[model samples]
Target: MWTKEFFGTDVYHLVSAFVIYSMLGWLVESIYMSFCNRRLTNRGFAKSPFCPIYGFGAIIGYLILHPLDGHFFKLYLLGALMATVFEFLVGNLMLKLFGEIWWDYKDKPCNYKGIICLESTIAWGFYAVIIIVFLHSKIIGFIDSWSFSMGSRVCSLILAIVTIDYIIQLSKAFGIDIRERCADKYESFKARWY
Candidate 1:
């Protein structure tokens, strides 16, 4: 009865929500990168509009705003916008403080002439927005109506494991034989694209 009253026994709503959120994350990241960070387009990081980081951020946002019921959609959008602002501010500040670019997007379409990448920043902002909106709207009750108690737990666990694995691989690549090779390849790749 509770499920019928809330989610209406249809998982499509959840699926659609995630899809839209992920798309928003991609759009926001792409737009920010294009307008704010010109170097990303010149590099190559913005080549693909679909980024794992943004998707992950969307999921995080969804979870945070899951309790808002009918207002979840509005909360999600607001959260996403808030996240965008945060990303913009934090990114510009970091670039101003640091002389070296930590992330490069030489292959993407950016408008800024610096060592700033807006992809990750967008993702971070998106996640932050979701959390803030969810907390503000109290949507956790609706989320509880779902059948899966372990859903969020399971997803978080998987994400952590995968992220750790990727980090380890990147570390090994940086330290091992692939370091120079990857760098060279990346350089060539940048040259080809930009």
Candidate 2:
């Protein structure tokens, strides 16, 4: 199957988890930003009710750090470290690609180039503990309750819609040739990373 070929076993479950966490992340970020700014703000890059970065972050935490599960201290510390690094990289990449930083911490204390701050990093640790310790089982149960066919169909539909929205929003936001920008940024990223 395409799922097995592209991803390892249980691809449906993983994708379901990613989609669920993404919508939740979008909700949380939207509410938080609205409250902070005293106005409603759509925090998602696309018009869809999704936050892909959050989905990826959660998946990375589950795959890489779940081994530390039960060890709260280890999970928190490592989750914090991993998430901070992820945030820093994503924040910088967004700036380089879009010429805009999605979130800035310039006014906040202990911020590194306004890309990440101590408070947010600490919060990520707590968020990690919550997701791993509390939400993991529920998510597994939810995914398993669905038949493979149903789960795959749902996830595919959601992902397809989100991808379309992302493409439209990308063009509207930058008003430039995305291919050119991507090529230039890819070269820059390659040079920097390599």
Candidate 3:
């Protein structure tokens, strides 16, 4: 019974795995940026860590590929390819429409034209690899045990973060001085109410 319980479905484990992998990707990129100590610039997008576009892309990738089984290596490769395509298309479209790049990898070894960094690509690839390997090996059966509610909650958290980040960025793009505006509004409200 204990053994069965230990191996039972645990949505928390799946959510934790996703969060860990995402955070690891951010950490790796931050380390790379720190070593360079230069603001990354590129032809297409703006430089930002909390890119909502990439967040959405990642989520999409998970949705599309997570249901498939068999041929772990092949699936991983296909997922990587899909991710790359998504990144490229989204980056280009954003540049064309908004005239800003959401990320910059200018100084990194794997960066090309500041638009796409090799580190990010490799990180995403590794993420897919981990999922594929784990699912195939059944070494950690937690993912299979995860509850739907837990999975939805995790995805919701990610989406909320991405939405907030995007809103901040849009405000920046429009040159809205949120800090100053908020201060002025607060002072006015205080004077009127008091």
Candidate 4:
């Protein structure tokens, strides 16, 4: 399986895959929302032009489903399961940490706690097959072909941008000045520990 190569070598490719998939995810979300709302909607949770959750989900699906690739239907089922679990965990974690929900599927059919639904899982299954069987191979090859120094520079730049975007978005989601909250938390921790 081409995925075997995905496991350990070439950290640059993994980083590239993560960033590329994130941007693609953002594009898909934006296009879908635009169609639904009849206007452009930047559906990204962060100020960055990418969606990390989708990128992580894509990697997870690829890793989980690649072994079962020869058996297409079974691979899809497992991929759906992995993606659903990943979605649910990220949703609940966001709700816990930020007091906000990125998405609510309550109005959707067969939704579970507004985190996931049968329809979405089915779609994820389809996406998983395409990603694992087709996209991963090509992306890995392309990234691997790049010079190590060049790949390192590009990937590092992307990582820095995403890190800054996450910090800003997290602060915004607090709905109050983040500096105040951080100061308060720091004081509390100091009082308890020192």
- Local distance difference test, per candidate? 0.49, 0.88, 0.58, 0.82
- Those runs of model 2 whose alpha carbons end farther than 4 Å from true positions after fitting are 2-9, 176-194
Highest lDDT, which number?
Answer: 2
Candidate 1: tens digits of C-alpha lDDT, residues 1-194? 11233333234334333434444556765676677766543221233333444444555445555555457456546565655554455456656754334355455455244333455445444455545554323433444555464545444454465456555554664465555777999999999999
Q: TM-score each candidate.
A: 0.31, 0.85, 0.52, 0.84
28-49 per-residue lDDT for model 3 (tens digits): 5566666666764221112334
- Candidate 4 wrong stretches, greater than 4 Å: 1-6, 175-194
Where in model 3 is the C-alpha error above 4 Å? 1-21, 35-55, 96-98, 104-126, 135-170, 187-194
Candidate with the larger lDDT of 2 and 4: 2
The order of the candidates by lDDT, greatest first, is: 2, 4, 3, 1
**Better candidate by lDDT, 2 or 3:** 2
Tens digit per residue, CA lDDT, model 2, 26-82: 999999999999999999988898999999999878888778889999999999999
Model 3, residue 43: distance off in Å is 16
Ranking by TM-score: 2, 4, 3, 1
lDDT of 3 at 138: 55
lDDT of 4 by residue, 1-194 (tens): 22235565445566788888998899998999899889989989877788989888887677667788778898788888888888889989988987767888898999998989998889888888889888889888888798777877887898799898888777777666877888999999999998
